[model samples]
Target: MRRKILKVLALAPFALLFTSCEKKISHEHREVHWDRDMCERCKMVVSERNHAAQVINKETGEAYMFDDIGCVILWFKEENITWKDTASIWITDVKTSKWIDARTAHYDTVHQTPMAYGFSANEKKESIVKDSEILNFEEMSKRVLQRGR
Candidate 1:
């Protein structure tokens, strides 16, 4: 009986470790503290509330924060990061500070951003700027990538 008890005690640590290793494999939006969190792309403090953006790698669950949507695009293109469908892209709505899926958010190119990308995100489908065209995530990314090239 003592030998059996010792064996169980020896396996307790391994069981604990195995159970603890079962972490959820998903990305979550992290809270950005203005003037505290720096942009991963520009290395500038993320001060903008509405233009803030975040990208999360699906496989690694690593998050990359940006001060502007333009910065996110530039970073992805410059790093040649693969934009996988499983990855999460978040952007702050211009009207509300709430996070929205970058792919579904409406993008306006006239609004001034922290990185001077002149792009902003909105939940509405219509473009707020009269002369500027509204773009989806792919269109905006292409526009920024083309400009970088």
Candidate 2:
């Protein structure tokens, strides 16, 4: 009886640890506070250190976030994203974490993220394109070299 009790006690900590380590997804509409330095979009508590963000049209304040670039593009395409009149688009560089234009983003076919696209901030790096020229789905397909389904 003593040995059985000790064994149960030893296993208790392991059970607790596993439960604590599990990811907690909230289905309720909880208020989210988003900081650019922390989360770029959705404003959820982002534990993923590799997260990135983009804001289109600072004036309009349109923005989006992604766990990875692929997720960002996937969300955009999946939702058939559309922009309002007189707006700009911006995206964060996974490396530098700086905001850049969305238009000039360099699309890489092969990346950890399927929608991996990046922009250069300065002359040294190619920044993502801003709202200087907005492209619709038709134009984007040609730029990314993929057909919009």
Q: lDDT per residue, candidate 1, 1-149, as tens digits?
A: 99999999999999999999986766778777888898997899998788898888978878888888888877876787776456798999886878998888888877777877676888887637577788888888888877762
lDDT of 2 at 131: 43
Model 2, C-alpha of 59: deviation from truth (Å): 7.3
TM-score of every model versus the real structure: 0.80, 0.37
Question: How far out, in Å, is residue 139 in model 2?
Answer: 9.4
Candidate 2 ranges beyond 4 A from true positions: 1-51, 57-62, 84-87, 107-111, 114-149
Number of residue pairs clashing in candidate 2, backbone atoms closer than 3 angstroms, sequence gap of 3 or more or interchain: 14
What C-alpha RMSD separates each model from the true structure? 3.4, 15.4
lDDT of 2 at 136: 38
The superposed Cα distance between candidate 2 and the true structure at residue 83, in angstroms, equals 1.6
lDDT of 2 at 11: 100
Find the candidate with the highest lDDT and give its number: 1
